[model samples]
Target: MRLSVIAKVLALPVVFFVCFFLVPLSVVLMSSLWVQNQLSFEHYLTILLDQYHWSVIWVTIKLGIYSTLICALLGYPLAWFMIRIVSTPLWRRLLVILLIVPLFTSNIVRSFGWMVLLGRTGFINETLQNMGLIERPIRFLGTELGILIGLVYILLPFMVISVGASISRIDRSLEYASRDLGAGHWETFRYISLPLTLPGLAAGSIMVFALSVSAYVTPALLSGGRVTVLPMLIYQQYSTVFNFSYGGALSIVLLLATLFLVAFANRLGSTKGGDK
Candidate 1:
């Protein structure tokens, strides 16, 4: 293709990105750097150097990493079952609908549902208490576990869909040949199937991690004001304190961190895929 043709092809998306993303980000960046109508780095220093902020960042990263790992561990088998085991088209369609139905509902509604389930008098606690699993109602509403459970539920569909698509694209011939050569199912999966699905796994994991890190509604509703994540902090600055500069700083930091982690994951996935 001619250079001009290629440029024309890219022009619309480039313009769209600049207008919608770049412009707003530029404004935030400038706002973050300006203090009392003068250029400064104090906001960045305040966020980065404070112990409370560090704890919040740590909590955010922990939530993201844990959620991603849990999703992958659970999603892989589910995806395999969907792609390779369940051969009935009708059942597969039903399963796919079940996976996606949660997405149609608002995040608030979903989080509220979890809150009901995890509350002191919630069904889960009552059942467990009645069954003698615990003497008292365990606290889940204001804890890390509560947040994680909600995140995993919300993010599992993404992982399953991504990995299922990848698994569907793999060559069945290779697996059959491996089996013919007397390789066990586990060996075939280890050497052929798993490697082939790494790209999808990586994509899904990154998506889940990014969303978990930035998640506000689920954590806010489930946390009951006890747990704090970066997004919540940013929200507080913008909503309660009316501090755009600090909020902008937090937003830029989050954006940069997400970009860096995603880029690293993409590079790692590409390298592993190439090796396989």
Candidate 2:
């Protein structure tokens, strides 16, 4: 009876996935296979065999991995500070609001803001010049570094919230016991807190990676058409060239890459959980 109830509860979500995600993905998969108004392997071969396509794939993977790693490194400390160091409820609420407000804004707005800030004569370069950091303005716009900065800033809040929630749910008694046992602050964190927050870290990393892989607006604005990623190619195929078959191929490849990454993360997460 309990199993039946569980199945009933899951029925709606399963149907929703089928109708929305699975159906659309199936269409793309079929379209990708259709070449020259007939079924063929030509589209897939073109994407896989092209050197430019390979370079774009490499760039996309590199950016996604770097962005995720940086977010985790920075976010975990911020999350810990929020949950542990910040004792005032009002301050915590305000900090959370500040973190989340950017998300409520449009991606275009956020990307444009970065573009201004990172431009050659932008405030960053101006301040650096004033402070004797450099003799001339350094180019940030249309650079990989600029894109990384934007992507990391946009994805950080998700990491902070995920890890913060996990840290909050952890029992304080465990930490107290570790302290009572003469463990230093670092030791307590390394042995007790860090291990406990692994699940949240895993979840946030996966979320950041997936979003980074598919990110278009931020990369488009930040890259200034200098650097091309897989999504950009896909967009060009569909929008400029009007090649739906080739676009569908690129789309399926991106989707498959994301799925492969998520599955790998899940497997690693399961292994870690089992070890515990």
Candidate 3:
């Protein structure tokens, strides 16, 4: 009777997952494999063999890497401050709310906001000029750097939350013990805290990287029609060209690539955890 009750509780979600995600995904997979009412690998071949597609993939991967690195660099310190340094629960809650509030806004709106700030005549450049840091405005729009800035801004909250959760779970007594043993602060953090947080860092990196690569709106607006990513190509195939076969193929390739990288990250995290 208990087992039956548990199964009943899980039934709705299982049915929803099958009906929404798996079924649509299966349709896409079938579409990718079928061309001209016949099974063919031509679309996949076209994407795999083309140098242009490779370049777009490289760019997408590059942006993902850059975004992940930037987010990690910025996130770790902020997470540490929030989790370890902030002693007041109220203050910590406030900070967390501030960090997450931006996420509630639309991505398109955020991207547009960055556009205004990053433009040549924008606030950033104007401030730099006023500070005499630069004689002229810098070009941020239509460049990878601009896109990176937006991606980092959008994804940093995920990293912060992930790392903060890990940090909060750590045993403070361990750090106290290390300090009692004459270990310096740097030594305590480097040897004890950092290793324990590897899994969280890895998880956060995976989230940031995956979102960065597949992101469309942020990249599309920030790129200013200058740069291209895999999603953009896929969108063109489906929406503009009406080539669902090729679009489905591109979608599958991106999905597989993201899954591969995520798996690699998870394995690496596990290995690191074991070593520690």
Candidate 4:
């Protein structure tokens, strides 16, 4: 009877997942495989064998890695400061509000904001020129660096929140005990805090990486048609070229690649945890 009740409780979510995610994904897979009403691997072959496609894939993966690494570097420090150093609840709350406010804004709006700032005559360039940083305004628009900046800005909050939550859950007594045992500040953090926070770090990194790879709007606006990524290619295939088969193949490739990378990250995190 309890098993029956448990199954009933799970029924809604199971049904929702099947109806929404699995069914649509299966349809896409079928579409990718079906060309001229016959099953074929042509679309996948084209994507895999083409040097241009490989370059786009590499660019997509590169951006994801850069964005994830930047977010992790910036987020971990900010999270540590918030959780470990901040003594005032009011100030902490204010900081959190500032972090979250941008998330509530539309991605298109935010991307457009970056477009203005990263443009040649934009605030960043003007300020740099004023400060004698450069003789000429650097070209940020239509470049990988511009896209990276936008992705990092958009994704930074996820990392900070994840790491901050983990840091907050860590017991202060553990650090105190480490210090009592003659561990220095860095030693205490390395032995206790860092290990304890690894799960959150991994989770945040995976989240940021996945989002970065799948991102369309920020890259689209910042790239200025000069740079191309897999998502942009997929969009072009479906919308402009009217090639659903190729688009579906691209989507599946991205989905599979992201899943593999996320699994690798999870495994690495687990191995590190075990070693610690």
Candidate number that wins on TM-score, 3 or 4: 4
Per-residue C-alpha lDDT of model 4 across residues 12-61, encoded as one tens digit per residue: 99999999999999999999999999999999998888999999999999
Candidate achieving higher TM-score, 2 or 3:
3
lDDT value, residue 142 of candidate 1: 94
Per-residue lDDT, model 1, residue 34, is 93
The C-alpha local distance difference test score for the whole of candidate 2 amounts to 0.92
Model 2 over residues 88-162: C-alpha lDDT tens digits?
A: 999999999999998999989999999899988898999999999999998888888899999999999999999
With a 3 Å backbone cut-off (N, CA, C), the pairs that clash in candidate 2 are none
In TM-score terms, which candidate is top? 4
Over 4 Å off, model 2: 1-8, 268-276
Residue 119 CA displacement from its true place in model 1, Å:
0.7
Worst 10 residues of 4 by lDDT: 267-276
Q: Model 3, 1-276: lDDT tens per residue?
A: 999999999999999999999999999999999999999999999989999999999999999999999999999999999998999999999999999999999999999999999999999999999999999999999999999999999999999999999999999999999999999999999999998898789889999999999999988999988999999988999999999988999999999988998888788767866886
List lDDT for all candidates, in order: 0.94, 0.92, 0.94, 0.94
Query: What's the lDDT for residue 157 in model 2?
Result: 95
Off by over 4 Å in 3: none
